[model samples]
Target: MADETPPVDEMLYEQLAQDALRGVIRSALERAALPAGIPGAHHFYVTFKTRAPGVSVPPDIMAKYPDEMTVVLQHQYWDLTVEATRFSVMLKFGGMPKVLSMPYTAVTRFYDPSVQFLLQFEAPATIEEIAVEIAAMPPAEVEPLGGDDAPKVVSLDQFRKK
Candidate 1:
C-alpha cells in the first residue's frame, strides 16, 4: 500500500514560528517595563542585525559592530519601549548613552542567562514593510557599569551559518 501522507502546503510555518517567538521577547520586555523593573535577577541579552532595516544606532558604534551586536539589559538601560513590531531602549557604551531602535524581525537571538533560556530565529530576507521612525531622545545620565557587570559583547559569528 502506498503512503497516504500529503505534501505540506506552503503555509509558511517557519515565518509563523519566528513571529511567535518574537512575541515572547516582546512579552518579556513588556514585563520588564513595569515600574518595579526586570523582576529579581532576570535580564536579557538581545543579539540583533546591526545593519538590518529599521535599526538605529550611533554612527560610530554602527561602524564598530557593522554586522551584529549583543546588548545586556541587566542594568543601566532606560526608556525601554516595546511596540507591536519593534522595541527601543537607551543603553550606554563608553559612558555615552545611545538609543537603539530595532524591529523584531532584526533580532536573531534572545537569551536570558538567569533562566538559561534561549531563542534563535532567522532574520527576514527583506524588511521593507517594517517602517519605523527613529525618534531622538534627550541624552540622559546612565550609571557607569563596573568591570564585572559591563556588557560582554562578543562576536556572534560562531552562532551563524557560513
Candidate 2:
C-alpha cells in the first residue's frame, strides 16, 4: 500500500501564526474599548517598539524609552481606540496625559499578569527596516553589538509536543 499524505504548501506558516497571535491583542483591545471595559480583573501589559514605523508617542516618551516601552491598560487609561492595523490610547505620565499610537506589528509582548498568560514576539523589523531606522537616528545613538551578545526571542515551539 502507498502512503497517501499530502505535501505541505509553500505558505509561510510562521507569519500566519504570528498574525493570529496578534489578533488576540486586537480582540482584547476591542473588548476594552467598549463601555464595560476590560471585563472582570483582566488587564494587559502591552510592550512595543518605540522606534518602529507607525508608532507615535510624546517626544519625551520617545526620548526616555528609545528602544521599547510597555503600557498598562488598566484603571488610569482612557480614549482607547483599536483599529485593524493600529490602536491608540491616552495614558498619564508624570501627571501629564500623553497619547500613544502604534501599529499592532510593533508590539513585541502582551501579558495578562492577572492570569499569568504571556505572549512574546520577535522584533518585527526586517534588515532593511532596521537599516533605515538606524540611519534616521542621530549618530550618537547608533551603537553596534556583537551577534552573540544581541538579545534573542524565545520560542515556545521547543516546549510543544512534536
Per-residue lDDT, model 2, residue 19, is 86
Which residue pairs come into collision in candidate 2?
Answer: none
Single out the weakest 10-residue window by summed lDDT for candidate 2.
153-162
Worst 10 residues of 1 by lDDT: 128-137
lDDT of 2 by residue, 1-162 (tens): 999999775686877898899999999999999998998899999999888878898999989998899999988899999999999999999999999999998999999999998999887663356566557755553235665455544443433212
Candidate 1 residue-wise lDDT, 32-96, digit = tens: 88788898889999999888877898998889998889999987899999999999999998998
- Give the total clashing residue pairs for model 2: 0
Q: Give each model a TM-score.
A: 0.72, 0.74
TM-score of 2: 0.74
Model 2 / residue 117 / CA error / Å: 1.1
The local lDDT score (0 to 100) that residue 67 gets in candidate 1 is: 82
- Give the poorly placed runs of model 1, Cα more than 4 Å off: 1-8, 126-162
